[model samples]
Target: MNVTIIGGGAWGTTLAQALTDNSHSVLIRDINEAFVEKINKRHIHPFFDIVIPTSIKATTDLDEALDFSEIIVLCVPTKAMRSVLVDINSKLTSKKLFINVSKGIEPETSKRVSEIVNEVIKKKYFGGYVVLSGPSHAEELILRKATALVAASVLKKNAKDVQELFANEKYLRVYTSDDVIGVETGGAIKNAIAIVSGVAFGLGLGENARAMLITRGIKEIVSIVVALGGKMETAYGLSGIGDLIVTASSMNSRNYQCGLRIGKGMGVEEAVGSLTQSVEGIRAIVAGYEIGKKYNLDLPIISAAYKVVNGQCSAKEALTSLLGRSLKEERYW
Candidate 1:
């Protein structure tokens, strides 16, 4: 299979390498000429420590990459999803499978990645859309570490096809599901919860506090997922609880690191500015807050995260307020 990855960031480059290892031809498209040139010349991503496979090709031309593959993998951040999809849609002359690996809701419209794709790409030209998400991170995957991810689509066949496309028994495993909403919702909102977990860690709140945050965070995620018409069971699967566990516990998560900085007394702007990579949770918290408001859902942790990250409240204040909320029976459903 030929695959065109529409981003040159760490995740995109990492996927290209993985595809090439699976004997699939991969082409990477990026707007940065310098980055593309460096990858084509050195087989090494400028930002990450991983080396790109020699078989993979990098280019700045969208048409050339689009024309070379039957499957287009989007690895760009959620913020860039709209423009990237528009560009791809303009060049698309026929239907092709699209696999979105980015996780987040659109800040302005609060739409998921699939909704943006559907809006940009006409239905007649639509082939299939699948969201590849879960606990897997680029840093671990690039080193051929064992990892698993979920491929979700409204159509089960589409999800299965994607599962087969990237499945590698040794290093990577792919699971298929028809719950696109659940998968995407889990992937997008977990980042916000992970920030709360990081704040706990930064405050030296101990393992119990971190555990409490993780458990309650899943409840918040499930409530929102169910409210948005997704399966509750999906929230317990790889993309939900699985992803939350890994991201909240690891330093590799940019969202967690951002929250860590905030808990250590740095302002949100200063912490965000200090990072070289995008902290997706910063955007996710705002989106989650909006979703909670629109749905009339109770999401204390997400709300607190939004307030802290936006500088409307300090982390300590937010934590105090959260603990002071009215007591109620724990509900898993």
Candidate 2:
């Protein structure tokens, strides 16, 4: 199958390598001329040290990419989702399956990527929307390390189709889920928690505190998932708890790294600007805070994270605030 990936960043370049390994022809559309030339001319990923397959190609033209294949894999961030979809809709000539690899709720609407797709794409041109998310990171995927991800959609067939497209017996595995709401909610909500986990570690609070944050963090994730009409069980599955464990604990996560910088005394703007990648956790913090208010859910961690990231309080102050809350029974179920 021919696949067109719309972004040429780390994740986009990483997926291009995976697709080529599966013997699928890939065309990546990115706005950076040097990045596009590097891939097309040298067959090298701009962000990683690994060399890409000669079979993989990239271009700067969105129209050419939209016409290249029926399978459109979106690797861009949530902030760029709407503009990219509007461009695709203008040039869409046939029904297309959108496989979104980005995670995070839109700050303006707090809508998931699937919702944004439906709002922008024409119904006649929309075939399906599948969200691919999990504990997998781009850095590991580039090395063909063992990775598992969930392909979720309301349509089971769409989910399975994605599973077949990315799954393999070697280093990558894909699971299908009909709980799109649960998968997307879990994927988005975990970013906020990951930031808090980073802050905990930056403060030199040992593994005990990290474990506590993750354990309590699962409750916050479930609350948002249930409020969003997602299944409670899905919160414990790969896209939910699985994703949280990986993202919140690792240095590979951009969100965690951002929080670490903030905890170590860097300003939020400077901490975020230091990373070459998009820090989805910052926006996820804001979106999660708003969702909590809209649904009237008690999300202490998310609220504290919001305050820290927004400059309303220092990391230590936020930690103190969290600890000062009235003691309550542990209710994870």
Candidate 3:
């Protein structure tokens, strides 16, 4: 399969490398001319330390990328997803399979990446859509570490195709799910919970607090998933609890790092600015808070995370607020 990846970030570059190593032709498109040139000449990303496969090509032209491949993998950030899709729509001459790897709700409209893609692309030009998400990180993935992911689509065949595209028995495993909503919801909101876990770690809170936050966090996630019409059981799968555990516990997670800085008394802005990569949890937490409000759901941990991330309350205050919530009979539903 000829694949074109639309972003030059760590994840995008990693995917390009993986696909190329699998003997699939890949073209990476990025706005940065220097980054493109670097990849083409050196097979290395300026930001991430991973060595790209020599077979992969890089381009600054979106039209060229769209023309080069049957499958387009979108790896841009959530905030850039709409604009990038709109650009792709303008250049699209025919139907193409779109696999979105970005995870997050649009802050302004609370739309998922697939929703934004559908809104931007013309109906006649639509081929298929698939979301690739789970606990896997680009850093680990590029090193050929074992990773599992879920490829979800309304159409099961499309999901299976995606699974075949990326799955390698040695390092990568892909599972298919019909519940796109469940998969996407798990992938997006887990970042917010990861930030809270980082905060707990930063505050010198030990295993007990981390366990508490993770347990309650999954409940918050499942509640939103159910409200959104996704299956409750999906929350326990690779895209849900699996993702939450890896993201919240690992220092490799940018969201967790952001929270760690905040927990150590650094300002949110400072913490965010210090990172070389985007901290998606900061944005996802706001969207999660909005979703909780829209659904009239009681998400104490999510609420606290939003408050802390927005600087509306200190981490300690947020923790206290969470602890002070009125106790009810414990329920997992």
Top candidate when judged by lDDT against the true structure: 2
- Over 4 Å off in model 3, which ranges? none
Better of 2 and 3 by TM-score: 2
Question: For residues 1-333, what per-residue lDDT tens digits would candidate 1 score against the true structure?
Answer: 889999878788888877888899989998989879878998887578557787878999999998998799998889988998998888888888889999898877778998999999978778889999999888888888999999999999999998888989789899999999999989999999998898888877888998999999999999988988889999999999999999998889888898888888888888888988777887888988999999999899999888887778889999999999999998877
The models' CA-based lDDT, in order, is 0.88, 0.91, 0.89
Ranking of all candidate structures by their lDDT, best first: 2, 3, 1
In candidate 1, stretches whose alpha carbon ends up further than 4 angstroms from where it belongs are none
Badly placed stretches (over 4 Å) of model 2 are: none
Question: Model 1: clashing residue pairs?
Answer: none
User: How much does candidate 1 score in TM-score?
Assistant: 0.97
Clashes of each: 0, 0, 0
TM-score of each: 0.97, 0.98, 0.97
For residues 100-193, write the lDDT of model 2, one tens digit per residue. Answer: 9998899889999999999999999999999999898888999999999999998999999999988888899999999998999899989999
Q: List the residue pairs that clash in candidate 3.
A: none
In model 1, the Cα lDDT at residue 187 comes to 92
- What's the true lDDT of residue 271 in model 1? 82
Residue 301, model 3: lDDT of: 92
Candidate 3, 1-333: lDDT as tens digits: 899999988888888877876779999999988889889998886467567788889899999999998799999889888899999999999889999998788878878888898899998888999999999888888888999999999999999999999988789889999999999888899999999999988988988999999999999999988888889888889988999999999989998999999899999899989998878888888888999999999899998888887778999999888889888999997
